[model samples]
Target: MGTPTDEDDGVAVALRDAVRTLTLDSPHNRNALSSRLVTRLYEELDRAEADPGTRAVLLTHTGNTFCAGADLSEASARDAPTDAPLGLAGLLRTLVAFPKPVVARVTGHVRAGGTGLLAACDISVAGPGATFAFTEARIGVAPAVISMPVLPRTDPRAVARYYLTGERFDAREAARIGLVTCAADDPDEALAPVLDGLRRGSPQGLAASKQLVTREVLAAFDRDTDTLAELSARLFASDEAREGMTAFLERREPEWAVRQTPAR
Candidate 1:
């Protein structure tokens, strides 16, 4: 396990036996996937892959929200480029194609691209009350880049329902829809059994097994990633997207949302 870098570095690595747990430490932003965080995550995962002692990788976080999705503040900045989505697409590819089993431990909420990261993991365990939603449509964009990994794992019916509604679903629904491995009152307890099982797999055996399981997912990435990324970037740069992001930052309802009577 490597010593944690400074808080500004955005990710921390802790090794427990053969498992390397990477914590998204940027709680100030609800562990939002900033460019620096994404790059450092890729680097750490790559390092774990190269290390002989590391057999599995765990993606966890340090806040109430597991991840709030892309950094909207960064995206809404007029000076910002569409590079964030491109980088996120690359990170999803890394997680999907990783030779080792990547597990995600979720204790809170996840939204938009965060769901993509969760879907790319080989296994994901969430607390019973943790919530998830695909929020791109609310923000005047589609979940294009994330669809690369998401579409294959999620039930088509569930995808159609949630993608269109942007409704928050609990962990149980996530598990039912094949988006999560399980939901437990105690997520760490739930993960213990999984990790105990994985620890017994041999290095070569695990590598080959991961390859076998991910073959279809890898093919999907290869077949459609560039097209999806382009779609993501185009939507991010659209006028409606700009208004949506601005409305979010200003804590106001977006123009597309109907004004409702304030509840007593």
Candidate 2:
């Protein structure tokens, strides 16, 4: 029932009895959190909430990379000067306050804002080979808006290291730091039990339970998002950030990356 089908295109939506399966299908950009994609995700979540049959939601991706964070292309193209990432912030809020249990099926690697998406989920099961990173630092911006959901789930020391370094960590390390629920060789097998249990719950029971459990997460979003989103937008548009993003897109070391001096 909850299987991939033809409709599994970009932001695929499927119903398996009471479970609403939402797949991120833009593999070209590795499911980058473009404003377009974020908007579609919000709509899907709305659909899931409105449908009484949707007792749970499973958010999965379509390609090797789960999500590569915000579309740098869009942020770099600040020609239009819009509130680019605020939509992403809104999407995260929608996920946090979502009524039903949201599950993330992590297939491969995740980065920056992608980590935030996973953190917002009620449960995230990742495969053994899947890697994770908070990469915004590499581009000269902090993981601002994402920090709302991400910080609450992860260890402070871990966040301090990864948030500043942008280093890739394996799924096991992610699980240890509480970024993921657990790492498994077979994510589907691990998620089966969780899905089965969620499917058995009545709509109101699932909704109320999720609200009660995630009340703190919702509170965090309410209190912190406006300021964080502003910081993210400002950083993304800064001179240094532009240079960092340009260097990344050009496949070269960013200007801020220091050159190694000869050993004394």
Candidate 3:
């Protein structure tokens, strides 16, 4: 766990006026959900949950890409697939069940599992510069583990299109689909009133209010995380997925993307 003074950590934690902000700072990798980053997130959440002075958690990033999803480079280098989805599952569960309100302030690109992080928040405000996509299918994997948080919060039709096609959409479309609370030209301005409301609510009142809405999301986690994690591991270990990941890393089209010739 890093204190506010830890300048070199992937997550920078700071408390101000009852809001504990966790800024993802690994811009080199676009704040990808590497093992270290996930672990730090867990630690910071634990700290915030235990602190009575913290009324809300603000999850944001310090770079142009809020998060680019899982660290594919690390994934490609692994000897065999670990239960990485399980780690992701636990993180999402923590965010969903955290007693304090979890808010997301996004102003950049969010991809793949990053959308899960956004969906798990109680309220999310994205700026005009924010763009989002579910790029898992392009990497030969389904958005399995993230569905627990995403499906309950977003429209099925919209998710189906993004999940299948992996197309990028602007923040406005994301807001329209209920993936975020709103799209604002200036997210910080949009978030001010929301944070004020959160700060005014009694801790008990906020926790109870959050539970009312998050009940079904928590239930989905109870029912699906294990199965989805297993499925995710299986898919990542497949030959086609390996090829797809390799192609992505190499900046080339995967085999499936190439046109097939007809036999005469």
Candidate 4:
């Protein structure tokens, strides 16, 4: 087995036999999505997909909070940036298109972009305390990127409601909505049994199954790429998003009016 840290510097990739493990390691920011992190993750994912020895990939994170979503700090630091690659969207697309299985082992609050990360995986196993939220609306952003893959995991109506509302949901609720495959008291233990099952399948069979499932889900939706682009543009430009981000940085409640807006 070999583990390599890609150039982007936020993700660590380890390969063992047919399994690859990718860990989000920006604990200082609770594994928040920074441009650097996103770029690195994409690179590593590409590597895993191309590697003939890899059949499955496990996505995990450090700290109690799995992923706090996009690093607002990073966004705030940027000035007049145009045409930056949309990280979350690209990652989700890669996962959905991946021929091999991708598993998520979630163990904390997965908010905003974090929730999207979970939704992108082929299967998700969350710890008992894991909570999820589509929080973009609160910050004046849309869950446009993550929504692409998330739609397949849960009821459309529920996704619409929750995503629009920006409310937090526990693991049980996630499973109920089909966003999670199962919840576990011990994530590592829970994953062992699932990995064992995956190990029984031939790599080619697993890859083919993954491809079929992805195609089936994609066939159901008529994605409006233009609409998503517009929404994301508006989200980044909205006053509510600015206010929500300010509040989060200050560790306080955003003004009530801002809170009412759905961020996801």
How close is every model to the real structure, measured as TM-score?
Answer: 0.94, 0.94, 0.95, 0.87
Encode model 3's per-residue lDDT on 78-168: one tens digit a residue. 5744878899999999999999999999999999999999999999999999999999999899999999999998999988999998999
Error of 1 at 200 (Å): 0.8
Write the residue-wise lDDT of candidate 2 on 1-264 in tens digits.
Answer: 357533533688888867888888898888998877887887788888888777888998877989999888878986834576677778888888887889999978899899999999999999977899998888889999888888888899999999988999999999999999999999999998999999888777877888887887788888987888889889998999999889888999987788889999
Predicted model with the maximum TM-score: 3
Candidates' lDDT values, in order? 0.88, 0.86, 0.92, 0.77
Clashes of 3: 0
Candidate 3 — which residues are off by over 4 angstroms?
Answer: 1-5, 259-264
Candidates 1 and 3: which is better by TM-score? 3
At residue 91, candidate 4 shows an lDDT of 68
Alpha-carbon runs more than 4 Å astray in model 2:
1-9, 261-264
lDDT of 1 by residue, 119-205 (tens): 999999999758999999998999898888888888999999999999999999999998888989999888888887888999889
Model 4, 84-157: lDDT tens digits are 32545666677777877899999888998787778778889998889988988777677876666677668888
TM-score, cand. 1: 0.94
> Could you tell me how far off, in angstroms, the CA of residue 48 lies in candidate 4 after the best superposition?
1.0
Higher-ranked by TM-score: 2 or 4: 2
Using lDDT as the measure, the top candidate is: 3
Give the range where candidate 4 is weakest over 10 consecutive residues by summed lDDT: 76-85
> What is the alpha-carbon lDDT of model 1 when measured against the actual structure?
0.88
